[model samples]
Target: MNSTTIITDTHTHLYSEEFAEDRNEMIQRAINAGVSRFFIPAIDSATTQAMYNLEQDFPENIFLMIGLHPTHVKENFEEELNHVTKELARRKFYGIGEIGIDLYWDKTTLDIQKAAFKTQIQLAKHYKLPIVIHCRDAFDEVFEVLESEKSTDLFGIFHCFSGTYEQALQAISYNMKLGIGGVVTFKNGKIDQFLKQIDLCHIVLETDSPYLAPVPFRGKRNESSYIVNVVAKLAEIYGLSEMEISAATTQNSKDVFGI
Candidate 1:
């Protein structure tokens, strides 16, 4: 790996209000820092337009994914799924994503969340694109859904992956890559200790920006440029050069998203 090679932020949220004041400037900073690729995950209907605008503003830097987020899943999930399907039919999306079961925030909608997740998985299969998952305190539930839908066509990333080594292996078995982000750099973020045992080929860099900012920037709003810190952390943990980690994860992201 060389400094000249570009690093990809496999998962990020540039559409969030956190970047409203200087989204373009933040993106330019990221590009200047050698972090060029941006994979944007959809939250719900409310973000579609903003996502589209971001893509139009920086077509080459940003790629998009379409799907309903689990936290937003409710009795009206059918309508949300309809929006996702319509978007997929209307144009192309890099992947079907930010989709999965999240029980951490709300457990009341578990059943509906599962249904929406499964439906999105089916959609990913139908479109022949990878799926980007958002799992939270429901790895078993997520694995159950993947188990039911397991096939060569089923694959994607476990975004913001903070699961145990065994769970990470389980996710890989389903053809999914682990989306490593800010948490890996936390003091108590246990993943760093065992991550070296995992191959870099199965990893991808992400920030989940506007949410989990990496250390030194922790508790503050995150942005794409902050992904450089994530790359540096992985380099330290894996005992490899920053360029090595960047190249390997960027390649892994390309493999998963077919970019």
Candidate 2:
């Protein structure tokens, strides 16, 4: 790994229980592999303290975002949104994120999910912060909200983007950067097929760690260091060097998060 190359995992849950046993060691491994910047996304109020703890432990490397994840939107969603509102009012966050529609898990909450996403987008605009969106099996639904919320202040990453080439362009239309991750390295991960068609500027790197581990590590726990594998895959996809991929995507992340 090139120590000079600074890889950024724009979307990762480092506070996840999966890393409880050796979180420090895991983060050190990622740093040693050149993944020095980590953007942590919130799941809900339940994970707020843990995210704060991660920031306290690694202040320089960890950047936090507060939002209620779509899947976590339920009966008490308004209360969760109130928590996000209060947190934003209380302190600074890099962005308002990990918020969007996830029909893959539940369709009954679509109305509430849309309401939460729109409300958070408003909050992001209010704070002049970018948003990190999570869209799973709900591109149409997600884009519907984005279309309505579209504006100069409406911008952020489409976290773990697994959309088609057209969808990629559509996301870019909304001023969103595509967040490529382990899925690109999957044998059936179709993003690799048309990724080269999209410019490197519209792309950023992520792991969505402890969830979508890349090949060789697939079906296993994912750590930030494994982002080097994603770098290698993007290098192959774009016919560029791994260092070039790292530099470009890291820059793209900074552009979105303003960090």
Best by lDDT: 2
Superposition TM-score, candidate 1 onto the true structure: 0.98
Q: Please report, in order, the local distance difference test score of every candidate based on alpha carbons.
A: 0.92, 0.95
Q: Give the TM-score (vs. native) of candidate 2.
A: 0.99
**Pairs clashing in candidate 2?**
none
Query: Taking the tens digit of each residue's C-alpha lDDT, what string does model 2 give over 181-233?
Result: 99999998899999999999999999999899998899899999999899999
| Candidate with maximal TM-score | 2
Residue 218 C-alpha lDDT in model 2: 95
Can you tell me which runs of candidate 1 are displaced by over 4 Å?
1-3
